[model samples]
Target: MLRVMTPTAVLLLAALPALAQPAHLQPTRDVSVTYRMNAPAAGGAPAAPQEMRMAFSVSEGKQRIDPPGNMGWMLIDRKANTAVMVMDAQRATMAMPPATVGAMTQGVPPGATFTRKGTATVAGLACTEWDVTAGQGRGTSCITEDGVLLRAVTTPPNGTPMTVMEATQVTYAPVEATRLTVPQGYSPMAMPGGAGTTPAR
Candidate 1:
Protein backbone atom coordinates (compact mmCIF):
# COMPACT_ATOMS: atom_id res chain seq x y z
CA MET A 1 0.00 0.00 0.00
CA LEU A 2 1.15 3.50 -0.73
CA ARG A 3 1.51 5.64 2.33
CA VAL A 4 0.23 9.16 2.00
CA MET A 5 2.71 11.65 3.35
CA THR A 6 1.40 14.12 5.87
CA PRO A 7 2.22 17.80 5.57
CA THR A 8 4.36 17.65 8.69
CA ALA A 9 6.39 14.74 7.35
CA VAL A 10 6.93 16.54 4.07
CA LEU A 11 8.08 19.70 5.81
CA LEU A 12 10.47 17.79 8.05
CA LEU A 13 12.01 15.99 5.11
CA ALA A 14 12.28 19.15 3.03
CA ALA A 15 13.65 21.48 5.72
CA LEU A 16 15.70 19.25 7.99
CA PRO A 17 18.86 21.19 7.24
CA ALA A 18 17.39 24.53 8.24
CA LEU A 19 15.47 23.40 11.28
CA ALA A 20 17.35 25.68 13.61
CA GLN A 21 17.23 29.23 12.31
CA PRO A 22 19.69 31.71 13.77
CA ALA A 23 17.91 34.34 15.80
CA HIS A 24 19.99 37.19 14.44
CA LEU A 25 19.17 36.34 10.84
CA GLN A 26 15.40 36.53 10.89
CA PRO A 27 13.97 38.49 8.01
CA THR A 28 12.65 41.96 8.70
CA ARG A 29 11.01 42.80 5.40
CA ASP A 30 8.43 41.37 3.07
CA VAL A 31 9.84 39.21 0.35
CA SER A 32 8.79 37.00 -2.51
CA VAL A 33 10.53 33.99 -3.99
CA THR A 34 10.02 31.43 -6.67
CA TYR A 35 11.33 27.91 -6.39
CA ARG A 36 11.64 24.90 -8.64
CA MET A 37 11.14 21.52 -7.05
CA ASN A 38 12.22 18.21 -8.52
CA ALA A 39 11.12 14.96 -6.93
CA PRO A 40 11.76 11.35 -7.87
CA ALA A 41 8.73 9.44 -9.09
CA ALA A 42 7.23 7.22 -6.44
CA GLY A 43 7.04 4.10 -8.63
CA GLY A 44 10.59 4.41 -9.92
CA ALA A 45 9.83 6.36 -13.06
CA PRO A 46 11.61 9.53 -14.07
CA ALA A 47 11.59 12.55 -11.80
CA ALA A 48 8.91 15.19 -12.06
CA PRO A 49 9.46 18.87 -11.52
CA GLN A 50 7.19 21.63 -10.25
CA GLU A 51 7.43 25.30 -9.53
CA MET A 52 6.00 27.39 -6.72
CA ARG A 53 5.92 31.01 -5.65
CA MET A 54 5.88 32.06 -2.03
CA ALA A 55 5.36 35.41 -0.38
CA PHE A 56 6.36 36.27 3.15
CA SER A 57 5.20 39.48 4.75
CA VAL A 58 6.15 39.98 8.35
CA SER A 59 4.80 42.85 10.40
CA GLU A 60 3.97 42.99 14.06
CA GLY A 61 4.66 39.24 14.30
CA LYS A 62 2.14 38.34 11.61
CA GLN A 63 3.05 36.44 8.47
CA ARG A 64 1.19 35.27 5.40
CA ILE A 65 1.99 32.68 2.77
CA ASP A 66 0.38 32.65 -0.63
CA PRO A 67 0.93 29.21 -2.11
CA PRO A 68 1.35 28.41 -5.77
CA GLY A 69 -1.57 28.24 -8.12
CA ASN A 70 -5.02 28.62 -6.62
CA MET A 71 -4.49 26.00 -3.94
CA GLY A 72 -5.00 28.58 -1.20
CA TRP A 73 -3.19 30.72 1.33
CA MET A 74 -2.31 30.78 4.99
CA LEU A 75 -2.16 33.52 7.57
CA ILE A 76 -0.25 33.25 10.84
CA ASP A 77 -0.82 35.78 13.57
CA ARG A 78 1.84 35.34 16.20
CA LYS A 79 0.46 37.88 18.61
CA ALA A 80 -2.94 36.26 18.55
CA ASN A 81 -1.34 32.81 18.42
CA THR A 82 -3.60 31.57 15.65
CA ALA A 83 -3.33 30.34 12.08
CA VAL A 84 -5.93 30.22 9.36
CA MET A 85 -5.82 28.25 6.17
CA VAL A 86 -7.90 29.45 3.26
CA MET A 87 -8.86 27.08 0.49
CA ASP A 88 -9.30 29.08 -2.65
CA ALA A 89 -11.09 26.49 -4.72
CA GLN A 90 -13.60 25.69 -2.09
CA ARG A 91 -13.74 29.13 -0.54
CA ALA A 92 -13.29 27.59 2.86
CA THR A 93 -11.12 28.51 5.80
CA MET A 94 -9.76 26.39 8.60
CA ALA A 95 -8.47 27.67 11.88
CA MET A 96 -5.58 26.25 13.88
CA PRO A 97 -4.12 27.12 17.22
CA PRO A 98 -0.56 28.18 17.79
CA ALA A 99 0.44 24.87 19.33
CA THR A 100 -0.56 22.97 16.23
CA VAL A 101 1.29 25.31 13.94
CA GLY A 102 4.36 25.11 16.15
CA ALA A 103 4.34 21.33 16.09
CA MET A 104 4.13 21.32 12.31
CA THR A 105 7.04 23.67 11.70
CA GLN A 106 9.34 23.12 14.65
CA GLY A 107 9.39 19.37 15.17
CA VAL A 108 12.78 17.93 14.27
CA PRO A 109 13.17 14.33 13.26
CA PRO A 110 15.08 12.05 15.58
CA GLY A 111 18.76 11.42 14.90
CA ALA A 112 19.01 14.39 12.58
CA THR A 113 22.28 16.30 12.71
CA PHE A 114 23.33 19.45 10.86
CA THR A 115 26.80 20.77 10.11
CA ARG A 116 27.86 23.98 8.42
CA LYS A 117 29.81 23.12 5.30
CA GLY A 118 30.69 26.41 3.65
CA THR A 119 29.07 29.22 1.70
CA ALA A 120 27.61 29.71 -1.72
CA THR A 121 25.57 32.20 -3.72
CA VAL A 122 22.08 31.51 -5.04
CA ALA A 123 19.72 33.81 -6.84
CA GLY A 124 22.34 36.50 -6.33
CA LEU A 125 22.20 36.18 -2.58
CA ALA A 126 25.03 34.91 -0.37
CA CYS A 127 24.19 31.85 1.61
CA THR A 128 25.69 29.38 4.05
CA GLU A 129 25.71 25.72 3.09
CA TRP A 130 24.79 23.10 5.63
CA ASP A 131 24.93 19.34 5.48
CA VAL A 132 22.23 17.35 7.21
CA THR A 133 22.10 13.66 8.07
CA ALA A 134 19.20 11.76 9.54
CA GLY A 135 19.20 8.03 9.97
CA GLN A 136 20.60 6.79 6.65
CA GLY A 137 19.43 9.78 4.62
CA ARG A 138 21.48 12.83 3.75
CA GLY A 139 20.61 16.32 2.57
CA THR A 140 22.10 19.76 2.08
CA SER A 141 20.70 23.28 2.13
CA CYS A 142 21.89 26.77 1.27
CA ILE A 143 20.33 29.47 3.42
CA THR A 144 20.70 33.22 3.12
CA GLU A 145 21.79 35.55 5.90
CA ASP A 146 18.18 36.57 6.51
CA GLY A 147 17.10 32.95 7.05
CA VAL A 148 15.78 32.43 3.55
CA LEU A 149 16.38 29.01 2.06
CA LEU A 150 17.87 29.19 -1.40
CA ARG A 151 18.24 25.51 -2.21
CA ALA A 152 17.89 22.05 -0.75
CA VAL A 153 18.59 18.52 -1.91
CA THR A 154 17.82 15.23 -0.17
CA THR A 155 18.78 11.64 -0.85
CA PRO A 156 16.56 9.20 0.91
CA PRO A 157 17.75 6.10 2.76
CA ASN A 158 16.00 3.81 0.29
CA GLY A 159 18.44 4.93 -2.41
CA THR A 160 16.00 6.72 -4.65
CA PRO A 161 17.30 9.65 -6.66
CA MET A 162 17.65 12.93 -4.87
CA THR A 163 14.88 15.52 -4.65
CA VAL A 164 15.65 19.19 -4.91
CA MET A 165 14.14 22.63 -4.42
CA GLU A 166 16.03 25.58 -5.79
CA ALA A 167 15.18 29.22 -5.67
CA THR A 168 14.96 30.76 -9.11
CA GLN A 169 13.98 34.31 -8.20
CA VAL A 170 13.99 36.58 -5.18
CA THR A 171 12.56 40.01 -4.66
CA TYR A 172 12.07 42.32 -1.73
CA ALA A 173 8.84 44.33 -1.70
CA PRO A 174 6.04 45.39 0.54
CA VAL A 175 3.29 42.78 0.61
CA GLU A 176 -0.13 44.28 0.03
CA ALA A 177 -2.63 43.89 2.82
CA THR A 178 -5.25 42.68 0.37
CA ARG A 179 -3.14 39.64 -0.51
CA LEU A 180 -3.27 38.53 3.10
CA THR A 181 -6.93 39.05 3.71
CA VAL A 182 -9.38 36.18 3.71
CA PRO A 183 -12.11 36.84 1.22
CA GLN A 184 -15.67 37.27 2.29
CA GLY A 185 -18.34 34.61 1.72
CA TYR A 186 -15.86 31.81 2.45
CA SER A 187 -17.20 29.10 4.70
CA PRO A 188 -15.41 28.29 7.90
CA MET A 189 -14.33 24.70 8.51
CA ALA A 190 -12.52 22.77 11.16
CA MET A 191 -8.86 22.19 10.50
CA PRO A 192 -7.87 18.67 9.63
CA GLY A 193 -6.26 16.85 12.51
CA GLY A 194 -2.92 16.72 10.73
CA ALA A 195 -3.15 19.67 8.38
CA GLY A 196 -2.05 22.49 10.63
CA THR A 197 0.90 20.53 11.95
CA THR A 198 3.10 21.80 9.14
CA PRO A 199 3.46 24.99 7.20
CA ALA A 200 4.64 23.21 4.06
CA ARG A 201 2.28 22.33 1.27
Candidate 2:
Protein backbone atom coordinates (compact mmCIF):
# COMPACT_ATOMS: atom_id res chain seq x y z
CA MET A 1 0.00 0.00 0.00
CA LEU A 2 1.20 3.50 -0.81
CA ARG A 3 1.55 6.13 1.93
CA VAL A 4 -0.25 9.49 1.81
CA MET A 5 0.73 12.45 4.01
CA THR A 6 -2.60 14.18 4.53
CA PRO A 7 -3.65 17.05 6.86
CA THR A 8 -5.84 14.58 8.72
CA ALA A 9 -2.67 12.57 9.25
CA VAL A 10 -0.79 15.62 10.46
CA LEU A 11 -3.44 16.41 13.09
CA LEU A 12 -3.14 12.87 14.43
CA LEU A 13 0.63 13.07 14.75
CA ALA A 14 0.25 16.14 16.94
CA ALA A 15 -1.51 13.84 19.43
CA LEU A 16 -3.73 16.68 20.64
CA PRO A 17 -6.08 15.89 23.46
CA ALA A 18 -9.28 14.16 22.41
CA LEU A 19 -12.16 16.61 22.49
CA ALA A 20 -15.77 16.16 23.42
CA GLN A 21 -18.09 14.60 20.87
CA PRO A 22 -20.64 16.78 19.09
CA ALA A 23 -23.89 17.21 20.96
CA HIS A 24 -25.90 15.10 18.52
CA LEU A 25 -23.42 12.27 18.17
CA GLN A 26 -24.07 9.05 19.99
CA PRO A 27 -22.55 8.80 23.45
CA THR A 28 -20.59 5.74 22.31
CA ARG A 29 -19.39 5.23 18.79
CA ASP A 30 -17.90 2.20 17.13
CA VAL A 31 -16.96 4.29 14.14
CA SER A 32 -16.02 2.19 11.15
CA VAL A 33 -14.48 4.30 8.40
CA THR A 34 -13.35 2.72 5.13
CA TYR A 35 -10.65 4.20 2.93
CA ARG A 36 -10.34 2.71 -0.59
CA MET A 37 -7.07 4.10 -1.85
CA ASN A 38 -5.82 4.04 -5.45
CA ALA A 39 -2.68 5.34 -7.01
CA PRO A 40 -2.30 6.72 -10.59
CA ALA A 41 -1.72 3.20 -11.88
CA ALA A 42 -0.50 0.08 -10.11
CA GLY A 43 -0.07 -2.34 -13.02
CA GLY A 44 -3.16 -4.46 -12.31
CA ALA A 45 -6.77 -3.35 -12.65
CA PRO A 46 -8.17 -1.24 -9.80
CA ALA A 47 -9.51 -3.40 -6.99
CA ALA A 48 -12.96 -3.27 -5.37
CA PRO A 49 -14.10 -1.98 -1.97
CA GLN A 50 -15.07 -5.44 -0.78
CA GLU A 51 -11.41 -6.29 -1.28
CA MET A 52 -10.18 -3.33 0.77
CA ARG A 53 -10.35 -2.13 4.38
CA MET A 54 -8.14 0.56 5.97
CA ALA A 55 -8.00 2.92 8.94
CA PHE A 56 -6.61 6.48 9.15
CA SER A 57 -5.72 8.08 12.48
CA VAL A 58 -4.76 11.73 13.04
CA SER A 59 -3.19 12.65 16.37
CA GLU A 60 -1.51 15.98 17.07
CA GLY A 61 -1.42 16.64 13.33
CA LYS A 62 0.16 13.34 12.28
CA GLN A 63 -1.13 10.42 10.21
CA ARG A 64 -1.05 6.69 10.81
CA ILE A 65 -2.20 3.98 8.46
CA ASP A 66 -3.01 0.39 9.37
CA PRO A 67 -3.48 -1.88 6.37
CA PRO A 68 -5.34 -5.15 6.24
CA GLY A 69 -3.85 -8.62 6.83
CA ASN A 70 -0.36 -7.32 7.75
CA MET A 71 0.70 -6.55 11.31
CA GLY A 72 2.43 -3.45 10.04
CA TRP A 73 2.06 0.23 11.00
CA MET A 74 2.69 3.47 9.07
CA LEU A 75 3.25 6.67 11.06
CA ILE A 76 3.49 10.26 9.76
CA ASP A 77 5.08 12.72 12.16
CA ARG A 78 3.80 16.33 12.16
CA LYS A 79 6.58 18.75 13.08
CA ALA A 80 9.21 16.85 11.12
CA ASN A 81 6.51 15.95 8.60
CA THR A 82 8.06 12.68 7.46
CA ALA A 83 6.57 9.26 6.85
CA VAL A 84 7.93 6.16 8.64
CA MET A 85 6.56 2.78 7.69
CA VAL A 86 7.05 -0.44 9.68
CA MET A 87 6.04 -3.62 7.91
CA ASP A 88 5.84 -6.90 9.81
CA ALA A 89 4.40 -9.84 7.96
CA GLN A 90 4.94 -13.57 7.67
CA ARG A 91 7.73 -13.54 10.25
CA ALA A 92 9.70 -10.88 8.37
CA THR A 93 9.99 -7.13 8.94
CA MET A 94 10.47 -4.20 6.55
CA ALA A 95 10.84 -0.48 7.22
CA MET A 96 10.35 2.54 4.98
CA PRO A 97 12.66 5.54 5.05
CA PRO A 98 12.15 7.87 8.03
CA ALA A 99 12.11 11.07 5.99
CA THR A 100 8.83 10.16 4.31
CA VAL A 101 6.19 11.14 6.94
CA GLY A 102 8.25 13.97 8.38
CA ALA A 103 7.80 16.13 5.29
CA MET A 104 4.01 16.03 5.42
CA THR A 105 3.65 17.92 8.68
CA GLN A 106 6.59 20.23 8.08
CA GLY A 107 4.94 23.65 8.26
CA VAL A 108 1.31 23.14 9.09
CA PRO A 109 0.03 24.31 12.48
CA PRO A 110 -3.30 23.99 14.24
CA GLY A 111 -5.97 26.38 12.85
CA ALA A 112 -3.94 27.08 9.74
CA THR A 113 -6.33 27.92 6.92
CA PHE A 114 -6.24 26.71 3.32
CA THR A 115 -7.88 28.26 0.28
CA ARG A 116 -9.91 26.43 -2.32
CA LYS A 117 -7.59 26.21 -5.36
CA GLY A 118 -10.69 26.15 -7.49
CA THR A 119 -12.21 23.00 -9.00
CA ALA A 120 -9.84 20.47 -10.48
CA THR A 121 -10.54 17.14 -12.09
CA VAL A 122 -8.60 14.24 -10.62
CA ALA A 123 -10.40 11.00 -11.61
CA GLY A 124 -13.16 12.76 -13.58
CA LEU A 125 -15.17 14.27 -10.72
CA ALA A 126 -15.52 17.98 -10.01
CA CYS A 127 -13.32 18.78 -7.01
CA THR A 128 -13.02 21.66 -4.56
CA GLU A 129 -9.32 21.84 -3.95
CA TRP A 130 -7.25 23.87 -1.46
CA ASP A 131 -3.60 24.55 -0.65
CA VAL A 132 -1.22 26.00 1.96
CA THR A 133 2.08 26.74 0.17
CA ALA A 134 3.55 28.93 2.92
CA GLY A 135 4.80 25.69 4.41
CA GLN A 136 5.55 22.23 3.06
CA GLY A 137 2.15 20.56 3.62
CA ARG A 138 -0.32 20.97 0.75
CA GLY A 139 -4.01 20.19 1.29
CA THR A 140 -6.28 18.84 -1.45
CA SER A 141 -9.54 16.99 -0.86
CA CYS A 142 -12.81 16.46 -2.78
CA ILE A 143 -15.98 15.72 -0.92
CA THR A 144 -19.32 14.51 -2.18
CA GLU A 145 -22.60 16.14 -1.18
CA ASP A 146 -23.16 13.30 1.24
CA GLY A 147 -20.00 14.31 3.11
CA VAL A 148 -17.92 11.44 1.81
CA LEU A 149 -14.30 12.38 1.08
CA LEU A 150 -13.89 10.90 -2.38
CA ARG A 151 -10.40 12.10 -3.33
CA ALA A 152 -7.44 13.74 -1.57
CA VAL A 153 -3.88 14.72 -2.39
CA THR A 154 -1.03 15.68 -0.06
CA THR A 155 2.51 16.62 -1.09
CA PRO A 156 5.30 16.76 1.45
CA PRO A 157 8.77 18.01 0.56
CA ASN A 158 9.96 14.61 -0.73
CA GLY A 159 6.63 13.79 -2.40
CA THR A 160 5.42 15.10 -5.73
CA PRO A 161 2.00 15.73 -7.27
CA MET A 162 2.37 12.33 -8.93
CA THR A 163 1.90 10.74 -5.52
CA VAL A 164 -1.85 11.26 -5.38
CA MET A 165 -4.17 9.14 -3.21
CA GLU A 166 -7.88 8.66 -3.94
CA ALA A 167 -10.22 6.97 -1.52
CA THR A 168 -13.60 5.63 -2.62
CA GLN A 169 -16.58 3.94 -0.93
CA VAL A 170 -16.08 5.53 2.48
CA THR A 171 -18.24 4.61 5.47
CA TYR A 172 -17.91 5.82 9.09
CA ALA A 173 -19.87 4.44 12.03
CA PRO A 174 -18.38 3.16 15.32
CA VAL A 175 -16.66 0.19 16.98
CA GLU A 176 -16.82 -1.51 20.40
CA ALA A 177 -13.18 -2.14 21.12
CA THR A 178 -12.32 -0.25 24.32
CA ARG A 179 -8.56 -0.33 24.03
CA LEU A 180 -5.72 -1.58 21.87
CA THR A 181 -5.23 -5.25 22.75
CA VAL A 182 -2.97 -7.72 21.01
CA PRO A 183 -4.20 -11.18 20.15
CA GLN A 184 -3.33 -14.12 22.40
CA GLY A 185 -0.98 -15.91 20.00
CA TYR A 186 0.41 -13.01 18.02
CA SER A 187 3.84 -11.84 19.15
CA PRO A 188 4.95 -8.25 18.80
CA MET A 189 7.84 -8.11 16.39
CA ALA A 190 10.71 -5.71 16.85
CA MET A 191 9.76 -3.04 14.33
CA PRO A 192 12.01 -0.27 13.12
CA GLY A 193 12.14 2.63 15.61
CA GLY A 194 10.93 5.06 12.99
CA ALA A 195 7.25 3.98 12.74
CA GLY A 196 5.89 1.89 15.58
CA THR A 197 3.63 3.62 18.19
CA THR A 198 1.84 2.76 21.44
CA PRO A 199 -1.03 0.38 20.55
CA ALA A 200 -3.81 2.30 22.28
CA ARG A 201 -2.64 5.86 21.83
Candidate 3:
Protein backbone atom coordinates (compact mmCIF):
# COMPACT_ATOMS: atom_id res chain seq x y z
CA MET A 1 0.00 0.00 0.00
CA LEU A 2 1.27 3.52 -0.84
CA ARG A 3 0.92 6.37 1.64
CA VAL A 4 -0.52 9.75 0.52
CA MET A 5 0.84 13.15 1.67
CA THR A 6 -1.43 16.12 2.38
CA PRO A 7 -0.50 19.48 0.78
CA THR A 8 -0.65 21.09 4.27
CA ALA A 9 1.78 18.50 5.63
CA VAL A 10 4.04 18.88 2.57
CA LEU A 11 4.34 22.67 2.95
CA LEU A 12 5.07 22.44 6.68
CA LEU A 13 7.80 19.86 6.02
CA ALA A 14 9.38 22.10 3.35
CA ALA A 15 9.50 25.07 5.73
CA LEU A 16 10.90 23.19 8.71
CA PRO A 17 14.57 23.47 7.79
CA ALA A 18 14.53 27.19 7.23
CA LEU A 19 12.55 27.71 10.43
CA ALA A 20 15.17 25.79 12.42
CA GLN A 21 18.01 27.98 11.22
CA PRO A 22 18.95 30.97 13.41
CA ALA A 23 18.12 34.51 12.34
CA HIS A 24 20.80 36.47 10.49
CA LEU A 25 21.50 39.82 12.15
CA GLN A 26 23.57 42.11 9.97
CA PRO A 27 26.31 43.66 12.15
CA THR A 28 26.34 47.48 12.40
CA ARG A 29 29.05 49.24 10.39
CA ASP A 30 30.85 52.50 9.49
CA VAL A 31 29.61 54.03 12.74
CA SER A 32 31.08 55.44 15.92
CA VAL A 33 30.43 53.51 19.13
CA THR A 34 31.29 54.59 22.67
CA TYR A 35 31.47 51.65 25.05
CA ARG A 36 31.40 52.04 28.84
CA MET A 37 31.88 49.18 31.31
CA ASN A 38 31.68 50.04 35.02
CA ALA A 39 32.52 47.44 37.59
CA PRO A 40 31.57 46.81 41.20
CA ALA A 41 33.08 50.03 42.40
CA ALA A 42 35.55 50.26 45.17
CA GLY A 43 37.06 52.92 42.93
CA GLY A 44 36.84 50.72 39.82
CA ALA A 45 37.34 52.77 36.67
CA PRO A 46 34.49 52.88 34.17
CA ALA A 47 35.29 52.43 30.49
CA ALA A 48 35.34 55.56 28.36
CA PRO A 49 35.59 56.25 24.64
CA GLN A 50 39.28 56.45 23.85
CA GLU A 51 39.94 60.17 23.33
CA MET A 52 41.37 59.29 19.94
CA ARG A 53 38.89 59.17 17.07
CA MET A 54 37.50 55.67 16.60
CA ALA A 55 35.37 54.25 13.84
CA PHE A 56 33.73 50.85 14.04
CA SER A 57 33.65 48.44 11.10
CA VAL A 58 32.93 44.85 10.13
CA SER A 59 34.11 42.63 7.26
CA GLU A 60 33.45 38.96 6.49
CA GLY A 61 31.51 38.86 9.75
CA LYS A 62 34.42 39.84 12.03
CA GLN A 63 34.23 43.12 13.98
CA ARG A 64 37.24 45.41 14.42
CA ILE A 65 37.80 47.99 17.16
CA ASP A 66 40.21 50.73 16.03
CA PRO A 67 41.42 53.79 17.86
CA PRO A 68 44.40 56.11 17.72
CA GLY A 69 46.22 56.36 21.04
CA ASN A 70 48.93 58.75 22.26
CA MET A 71 51.41 55.91 21.83
CA GLY A 72 50.34 55.25 18.24
CA TRP A 73 47.41 53.40 16.68
CA MET A 74 45.67 50.77 18.75
CA LEU A 75 43.68 48.36 16.61
CA ILE A 76 42.05 45.40 18.26
CA ASP A 77 40.26 42.68 16.30
CA ARG A 78 38.91 40.67 19.21
CA LYS A 79 37.40 38.05 16.95
CA ALA A 80 40.77 37.51 15.26
CA ASN A 81 42.87 37.76 18.44
CA THR A 82 45.11 40.28 16.66
CA ALA A 83 46.37 43.60 17.94
CA VAL A 84 48.91 46.36 17.31
CA MET A 85 49.96 48.71 20.13
CA VAL A 86 52.41 51.12 18.56
CA MET A 87 54.48 54.20 19.31
CA ASP A 88 56.17 56.31 16.62
CA ALA A 89 59.89 55.44 16.32
CA GLN A 90 59.81 53.49 19.60
CA ARG A 91 59.90 49.74 20.25
CA ALA A 92 56.42 48.29 19.57
CA THR A 93 54.86 45.73 21.90
CA MET A 94 53.73 42.65 19.95
CA ALA A 95 52.53 41.22 23.26
CA MET A 96 48.89 42.28 23.60
CA PRO A 97 47.11 41.78 26.96
CA PRO A 98 44.89 38.90 25.65
CA ALA A 99 41.30 37.77 24.99
CA THR A 100 40.23 39.25 28.28
CA VAL A 101 40.33 42.46 26.24
CA GLY A 102 37.17 41.36 24.44
CA ALA A 103 35.17 41.40 27.65
CA MET A 104 34.95 45.02 26.53
CA THR A 105 34.26 46.49 22.98
CA GLN A 106 30.78 47.13 21.58
CA GLY A 107 28.10 45.83 19.19
CA VAL A 108 27.23 42.19 18.92
CA PRO A 109 29.70 39.38 18.38
CA PRO A 110 30.04 38.37 14.73
CA GLY A 111 28.64 34.88 15.47
CA ALA A 112 26.48 35.43 18.55
CA THR A 113 22.72 34.76 18.32
CA PHE A 114 19.61 35.96 20.19
CA THR A 115 15.89 35.33 20.57
CA ARG A 116 13.29 38.11 20.89
CA LYS A 117 11.45 38.14 24.19
CA GLY A 118 9.07 41.00 23.41
CA THR A 119 8.85 44.62 22.31
CA ALA A 120 8.98 48.06 23.91
CA THR A 121 9.48 51.71 22.95
CA VAL A 122 12.25 53.77 24.47
CA ALA A 123 13.20 57.38 23.95
CA GLY A 124 10.53 57.31 21.23
CA LEU A 125 12.20 54.47 19.32
CA ALA A 126 10.42 51.15 19.31
CA CYS A 127 12.69 48.36 20.59
CA THR A 128 12.86 44.63 21.15
CA GLU A 129 14.47 42.90 24.12
CA TRP A 130 16.20 39.64 23.35
CA ASP A 131 17.74 36.85 25.41
CA VAL A 132 21.25 36.39 24.00
CA THR A 133 24.04 33.87 24.59
CA ALA A 134 27.50 33.76 23.01
CA GLY A 135 31.08 32.52 23.48
CA GLN A 136 31.60 35.89 25.19
CA GLY A 137 28.90 34.93 27.70
CA ARG A 138 25.11 35.05 28.25
CA GLY A 139 23.23 38.35 27.91
CA THR A 140 20.14 40.13 26.69
CA SER A 141 20.44 42.37 23.62
CA CYS A 142 17.50 44.67 23.17
CA ILE A 143 17.26 46.18 19.74
CA THR A 144 15.10 49.04 18.67
CA GLU A 145 11.67 47.73 17.78
CA ASP A 146 13.29 48.32 14.40
CA GLY A 147 15.70 45.44 15.24
CA VAL A 148 19.12 46.66 16.28
CA LEU A 149 20.85 46.23 19.66
CA LEU A 150 19.84 49.20 21.77
CA ARG A 151 20.42 47.55 25.13
CA ALA A 152 21.96 44.32 26.42
CA VAL A 153 22.08 42.64 29.83
CA THR A 154 25.04 40.29 30.29
CA THR A 155 25.22 37.78 33.15
CA PRO A 156 28.41 36.15 34.36
CA PRO A 157 28.80 32.35 34.73
CA ASN A 158 28.89 32.26 38.54
CA GLY A 159 25.57 34.09 38.50
CA THR A 160 26.40 37.78 38.71
CA PRO A 161 23.14 39.59 38.09
CA MET A 162 22.91 40.85 34.55
CA THR A 163 24.78 44.11 33.94
CA VAL A 164 23.07 46.44 31.48
CA MET A 165 24.76 46.86 28.09
CA GLU A 166 23.00 49.56 26.17
CA ALA A 167 23.89 50.79 22.72
CA THR A 168 23.24 54.22 24.25
CA GLN A 169 24.19 55.84 20.94
CA VAL A 170 23.91 55.08 17.21
CA THR A 171 23.62 56.63 13.74
CA TYR A 172 23.38 55.07 10.27
CA ALA A 173 26.10 57.29 8.80
CA PRO A 174 29.28 56.24 6.99
CA VAL A 175 32.54 56.76 8.90
CA GLU A 176 35.04 58.79 6.86
CA ALA A 177 38.79 58.28 7.20
CA THR A 178 41.08 57.23 4.38
CA ARG A 179 42.52 54.48 6.52
CA LEU A 180 41.59 51.95 9.18
CA THR A 181 44.63 50.48 7.56
CA VAL A 182 47.65 50.02 9.82
CA PRO A 183 50.61 52.22 9.15
CA GLN A 184 54.11 51.12 8.24
CA GLY A 185 56.62 50.25 11.03
CA TYR A 186 54.20 48.64 13.45
CA SER A 187 54.32 45.30 15.31
CA PRO A 188 51.66 42.55 15.31
CA MET A 189 50.52 40.83 18.50
CA ALA A 190 48.25 37.83 18.98
CA MET A 191 45.74 38.40 21.76
CA PRO A 192 45.56 35.45 24.16
CA GLY A 193 42.00 34.34 24.86
CA GLY A 194 40.49 34.13 28.38
CA ALA A 195 41.34 35.87 31.66
CA GLY A 196 44.88 36.67 30.65
CA THR A 197 43.91 39.45 28.20
CA THR A 198 41.73 41.65 30.39
CA PRO A 199 43.55 44.97 29.95
CA ALA A 200 43.94 47.12 33.07
CA ARG A 201 44.05 50.28 30.99
Candidate 3 per-residue C-alpha lDDT over 1-201 given as tens digits, one digit per residue, 9 for 90 to 100: 111111111111111111221242433454544433332333433444322233445542223233222444444454554443443345343334433333333345557665767876543456666666656556555454222444445575667654433333555555444344445545543334412222211
Clashes of 2: 38
Order candidates by TM-score, high to low. 1, 3, 2
lDDT of 1 by residue, 94-167 (tens): 76655556643444567778788888988889888777776776777777777677777777667654646778
Query: Top TM-score: which candidate number?
Result: 1
| TM-score against truth, every candidate | 0.72, 0.42, 0.48
- Stretches of candidate 3 exceeding 4 Å from the true structure: 1-24, 41-54, 58-62, 66-114, 121-125, 133-137, 144-148, 157-160, 189-201
Question: Among all windows of ten consecutive residues in candidate 1, which has the lowest summed lDDT?
Answer: 1-10
Better of 2 and 3 by lDDT: 3
Ranking of all predicted structures according to lDDT, beginning with the best and ending with the worst: 1, 3, 2
**Positional deviation of residue 184's Cα in model 2 after best superposition, in angstroms:** 3.5
Task: Give me the displacement of residue 3 in model 3, in angstroms.
Answer: 67
| lDDT (Cα, 0-100) at 61 in candidate 3 | 23
TM value for model 2: 0.42
